[model samples]
Target: MDCTTVSLPFEMPADACNVHLHIIDPAFPNDGKAASQIGTVETYQALVNKLRLPRAVFVQAKPFALDNACLLDAIQKFGPDNARGIAVVNNTISDQGLEQLHNGGVRGLRFSVWNPDNAVVSFDDCAPLSERVKHLDWNMQLHMGAAQLVKWADIIRRLDCKVVIDHMGRLDPALGVKDPAYPFIQEMIDKGNTWVKLSGPYLNTKTGEPWEDATRTAVAIAEFAPERVVWGSDFPHVTEKIKPDEVVLTEMIATWLPTKKARQLALADNPKELYGFV
Candidate 1:
């Protein structure tokens, strides 16, 4: 996808932030997954520049697992002022280690329960880790599918810090609001401590690009918690065999957030609060 040729249907606020994306550098050791050819700081910067988003959050990619060297390096390269990270850390991390990560611009911990065998942090680690980071004002970012959402509802409700659900709770868009897990997600949002990333429609969408099926789910989530929703490109889109055009992905924000005010909140204001971006 040529990002340069793609344009947004509506103008984004100058402070707009892409709250979800990844930067995979081969310089760091990997978890043996095939590295994405286009996953790099330079390529991501180009995409964000083309989309006019000045801020970004470097999510810990699956390939790097618990070793955050690549994630930290990307954050350093992007500059702390313009970037923050969500790292994959376990319960055994020392106080000083957590402090170092916090100082290095990591504001949250990510727990991936979607792929259990490969998940660095399991459901059992979430609560204890959340308690550990509560004083730092860090949030827990959960990357899980619909079944996991339902399976982990109790633990999710008891989390000590704020929670961010990755990829619209990984719900199947064809089911729209009727998806069994939708109510559980809505319940979490109503608690006022949970935020949802309106990202990765491609991950669950049965329909192709423009992703009309997924749009329903995204809009439903945005409407349910306008202040709690944020947008992400899911760049490099590693899980897919073919990448979706970054341009089209950026423009989809127009449909998810239909008004300038809504866009401002999701793209700019919401991220600042969620990520602690100055």
Candidate 2:
């Protein structure tokens, strides 16, 4: 959806970077990639200008795993001052190369266990890689099916660096707040190292837009760990059959939080801290 169609509930902070964005280039071969959402530095810059949110965190989409050229290029094109990235790397990468990535504005590493077609890293690599990047102060971020969160609990708990879980732990609505998964996440948050991305209600929702089920979970997270909560547009929305308008999604976040102070923290302050955005 275009920016003019909807009214934003609160004023957007000038430098707010939508926490999760993917830069897609057809020149790169994405192995197991499905969505046709093609975004580039140029289009994204226009988006930033129109939205007035000056920064963005770029996650290397699955299709381009191991080949970080596109992701790095966008970060540079967007200017490291306003763009940061989460790259996908395996043990094969060298220490100097990693330092290069860090110097180039990559602040995190990602693993996607939920979608095998898009996944490049194995469960075995989580801890080792988590250990590898700890020196850089980089967080380990991953996306997995909800139930599988239980399997990796111990590994995540042992990480020396911070961790980020996408989409409200991908919790199933059927699982009440008291479920083992939420408690595990609560435990992580209590330890002060885990942050949750309030994103993709369309990914977890059964009822569709306005996704009350996912909304409740996101709001609960904001309440439970406001400092650890951050928002994402999941821009270019590759997963959905029909993309939800970004404007509506932004409005949904504003409505969910309802107060200017809370929304500003979620949209800008918290993200600036998480991504180290200037």
Candidate 3:
């Protein structure tokens, strides 16, 4: 079997913007053979070259699965100045640890109720996490579905820190852009304390390839919150067999969000504002 893989379109230059963050995942696969071969410095360097060696590459550390020690080690080798990070945390992340992560250039925390393995942070827990982050002025990025929209809408409204919805609030494709749940996302955007990432078609698409099913939803989000909308290439898609190639996904995004100004906002400018990239 061929181990070779297809890479994204090379037409675009790497100096596209201030370091395009890779949102790195540090968790090595459990399978020893695969783990030893990939997830190394050489592997990451190759991947970065493939990404056109973004000006600054920030990786979302594998907070839930890996120890902070391992994360720090990776940063030391990965050019700390050229990188930044996001972490997973709940009430348990000690005050000291959070402060340290802040110093390390981690500007936000991601909480996902969608993953079965991760514990959901309840409202009681969320309030304090919101409080903790408020001091640092870091935002909270959340992942959820239609079922949790009402709950999240209220939670974000009350929270002090800005909230970013991952994967366009991870909408269900069956709902399309007109879903009542989508309005809640729009409402949050309208409220002016929220941002949404135009990433991960699998989260919103019902069928395979050419995930246009998500276009209307993305467009609606762009329409509702153009200033707050940003795009990400959820690279090395974990645990999904139907993974999207980066080039194709980028092209799809370009198609869905046509217009030079929209592309600049979605691809470069908006992310800088939300993520604080200079």
The lDDT leader among the candidates is 1
**Every candidate's lDDT:** 0.87, 0.80, 0.62
Winner of 2 and 3 under lDDT: 2
Clashing pairs counted in every model: 0, 1, 3
| Candidate 2 Cα deviation (angstroms), residue 215 | 0.7
Identify the superior model by lDDT, candidate 1 or candidate 2: 1
**Strongest candidate by TM-score:** 1
Count: clashes, candidate 1: 0
Give a tens-digit lDDT track for model 3, residues 73-117. Answer: 455566665454656666888899899988877777766666646
User: What tens-digit string does per-residue lDDT give for candidate 2 at 157-270?
Assistant: 898888899877788865535456888889988998889888888886767777887788788888888888888888788887788876678778776676777777877788
TM-score of each: 0.95, 0.93, 0.80
Clashing pairs in 2: 30-63
The true-versus-predicted C-alpha distance at residue 272 of model 2, in Å, is 2.2
lDDT of 1 at 4: 70
